[model samples]
Target: MPNLLRKSFNVVNRVRHTASVAGLSALRVAKGERPDAVMLRETFEQLGTTYIKIGQFIASTPSLFPRDYVIAFQGCLDQTTPLPYSYIEQVLKEELLTEGQSLEDLFSKIDKEPLASASIAQVHAATLPDGREVVLKVQKPDVEVIMQTDLGVLHGVTKLMEKLMPQMRFASISPIIDEIRIRMMAETDFIAEASNIRDFQQFLQMTGNTKVVAPEVVEELTTKRVLTMSRLHGISMVDEVAMRQYCDDPAQVMADTLNTWFASLMFCNSFHADLHAGNLMLLKDGRIGFIDFGIVGKLAPESWQACMGMMQALQDNDYVTMASCMVDMGMTHERDKVDQAQLAGDLAKMITRIMAEDKTYTSGKPFNSKEQADELNKMMLEIVEVGKRHGIHFPRDFALLTKQMLYFDRFMRTLAPDMDMFSDARVSLLGSDFKQ
Candidate 1:
């Protein structure tokens, strides 16, 4: 009865945003009027935060979702209506007062208007009593409760689907949903995010990538719901015009960005999973500023080994080693039943196809060329298809790493037109203890 009541409430809320009872035939009209991907994107936008977050998650995983859905959800921006300052102040006071400090006692001033607004939290520029500049990341009001309710709904649905069709169990929707829940819960807690920022900064220093920097997280002014961190001033990485002004060598700046991030995958305990343009910036000092440490990725020891092997093979253009690594990574079924030679040959053909489409291995903008982009996407999908045909399933982190590389690829096309990404001596991937 309790579950029924909750489901009723969620459906009612969705109905208010999704549709209404105009007439008996109105439901059919609504279905016809909107295509699945477009309708889903629109509904997510209308349903607000949790759905928007789910959409963002789908947008990030092109390998997991249908290509058209991924393309459509990319249009679903994070920009939303700002919460009132009164609520923001309330959250700040409640969080800081728990530490035996009032807002006035700690912060000299906090901008009533937000510095920036995102799907989950809105940031406010603030100054400490000691004149230290910082930004307060305040959680949206009752977001935890809303997320719990929505996730419960998703979980219940997945359970039902699995029960109805056992193949759904193989797809592992429940575990994936649980993973998303844990990550989303972590994002809500500013303290954990603060730790992530510091750790990445440490990783940067350890790797000697002085050009890449993460913000300094302030502990005293931080709580689970609210995070205060040193404000980083810089031009966003996407602003090519401003980037040229910040540094004479934009190409080198971009290399430093990729090198630091790549190094983190091997050296850091966790790599920044979310590298969307919003979180990366080029500081006034010409260093890369990595902000918002929410959504990080980690790999098991064996996974890292497989990743290293794959990276080495990619650089050497050793298709056979690449094929073996893919099998080791569990990108295929029944390892003893696999044909190594055929897999390697298929990979070679795909690479040849990409090379034929665009020769600008250095200067060619594959990202901008529709023919090149299609060729690349088709090549990647074909590899996945062949592996799946052989009963291969890739690890989730494999998809995450692939997506981040695609982002770096776009950055290369824009910032570093003439540089070799993997083969460059400056582009380091090995950790201190890594044998290779």
Candidate 2:
């Protein structure tokens, strides 16, 4: 009976949310706005959580969505207004309370004001009874219910649209809806995120790497909805001036980051997938701190071996080997359809043209200019296009990998202007002997 009541409440809440979204969109239309991708993205951001995840999905998935929509949803904000403290306290009480223990029994201090707020969770700076500084990551009230309900609503809508409108079939809306459900559900599971952090920490320890770290999860204080982690003090990696206070050379930080990340591709259970500026930091202790393990990517062993091969090939300017490794990394419905030689020739031409047009690489300078960045993006996209032409479709993990590599490229341009990413002696591609 309780479960049924909860389900009913969730449906009612979803209905109200749908009505609100419709009303807001209608008002915008009445103001003489056409229903374009930008407007839709705005609507998604305003809707929060599930919709924002969908928008991000669109942004990350160039192979699945159109160019204009993908471009518009780039860097879609995950931020939202902070929920009230009363609600947060209530969740803590419910999730952490025991037979005789109270809030005071657990924490010495939990700040009412949030340090940061996002669509799904709010972070508060806190102190343990033993005087340890930590952060409380509390999920918004009913966020799980809301996300599940919204996904159901979106799934149904997508199915209906696909049946009624043939033109919508190309977007593969239903599959996207399914993928969003999996990702959003995982995000809501703080326990899983905590486990990811632990796994990464283990990876670091095993590799004898002390230059990089992730926040330590306070297991006793953590739950599926709320995560408690040791607080880290640092400056964002991109802020080179602020970083100089702790580290002499910020470029070394980037090198440590690159090496650690590349090693994780073959050695760790999963690699950090969403490592944007916000998630990476140069700690006051002169270490690179990787935080927010909410999203991770696990490549198959065979796929990773191929990825290593591809990287080595790139360094050697061996486009033929790179093309073959790409075939191994990506999936295809029709294996016989792929023409390896043709794909190799296309890749060779693409890289040559890009290098010639950009001149950044040959000029021995940082790829800082917008034109250089665009050329890099074009090269990645053209690689994908070439793969598609040969009937190969890169997996979601490949997209995540590519996106992080691009982010690292930006970081390199800022911190290590003269460094060559492909041949940098400090960066490790896990070497030829690395095996999972």
Candidate 3:
């Protein structure tokens, strides 16, 4: 009971601090003194890991955040002060000694410094006793406890925001918080991540695609809190200049990456939800290395079938079927007085405009001009606005799909300027029928 009270007090204090800072920041922006992205980045860094992870989440989900905030938070770095070596030793000793093995029994040597430190865990470089190089991802002590406290505070804040700003259509905060909680819990379990790695490896093998690589999980060396995996060396896929220097066909690399993701949606039961440049790499052997399978989305067999139906309907210009399929997928609310026909018409009109834009830009012109990108963003915003007016709430899974497509869009603009993503034979969401 005392512990619970302390945790509740901590949550309340944190929420108050966050509210104060946000209020001051809003006031500054209102006075025309907008906070610099660097300042915001620093603020998150000082605020600790949960906020840093939230910033990273905001950076990844552009559809859910304001443009300026998303762009600003993208610069938020995840560098954390390393826990002491004594703490690391203690954790390893506690977690590894149960099976009659000590830290030295498994690893020939463990580095005192970590390779990377984020919100929940830190990665350290190590070498197995069998002479294999590996990276050890160790979870922080009592991370779950801290996360629960922080998330509770976050929920409280979200409630306050909804009550204060009733005009803002901010979606249900509870569901969003629950989703975050679930994903974070999954991330905290190294065993689950190892399973994701193995599943992705099997997926790559089954697809007969040797161009993509998933890291090999070292099962013998893995535990619930600790994961050992093969270390990969490569340049980020987003580094166009570096990738160009390494590969003769960066365009093909981009295409293969997109196709790999598409195949995951069609074949694999689970797909990587986060595919930012940091998580994608152009390996030395020309294979695309996909890392960080912490956040993933799974479509049930029924859901996948429904998605395929919706895609086909969109391709064939069947507005009624598309709207019905969307409703089946729970994208809109079921109100007794809702006008299904009007909703279908609105959806169809919106799809027509989007398809017309693709038709007009079939040449696949370079997206170098800020004006062109801004126009595209404005079109997307307008679509979101229309959907909101119809009481249609886009699910997070849809947002994840759209986010991956946007990455493909940017990559295509840079690599294959002559290839239209919507009209190209290479990009097919509904398989061969939708191929250009």
The digit string of per-residue lDDT tens for model 2 on 1-436 reads: 9988987887797879777997999898999999899999988887878889889877776666666787799869888888899999999998998999899999999999998898889999999999999999999877888888888888888889988998999767788788778877999999999999999999888888888989999999899989999999998888788889999988888888888888888789999988888899888889889999998988776786787788778657898899889888756656567898998898889788878776676887555665677666666666666677677876767767776887787888778876766677876666322334
TM-score of 1: 0.84
Give the best candidate by lDDT. 2
User: lDDT of all predictions, in order shown?
Assistant: 0.75, 0.83, 0.71
Model 2 pairs whose backbones collide: none
On lDDT, the stronger of 2 and 3 is 2
Q: For each candidate, what TM-score against the reference?
A: 0.84, 0.90, 0.76
**Whole-model lDDT, model 2:** 0.83
- Ranking of candidates on TM-score, top first: 2, 1, 3
Worst 10 residues of 3 by lDDT: 427-436
Q: State candidate 3's TM-score.
A: 0.76
Q: TM-score: which is higher, 1 or 2? A: 2
Candidate 1 vs 2: which has more lDDT: 2
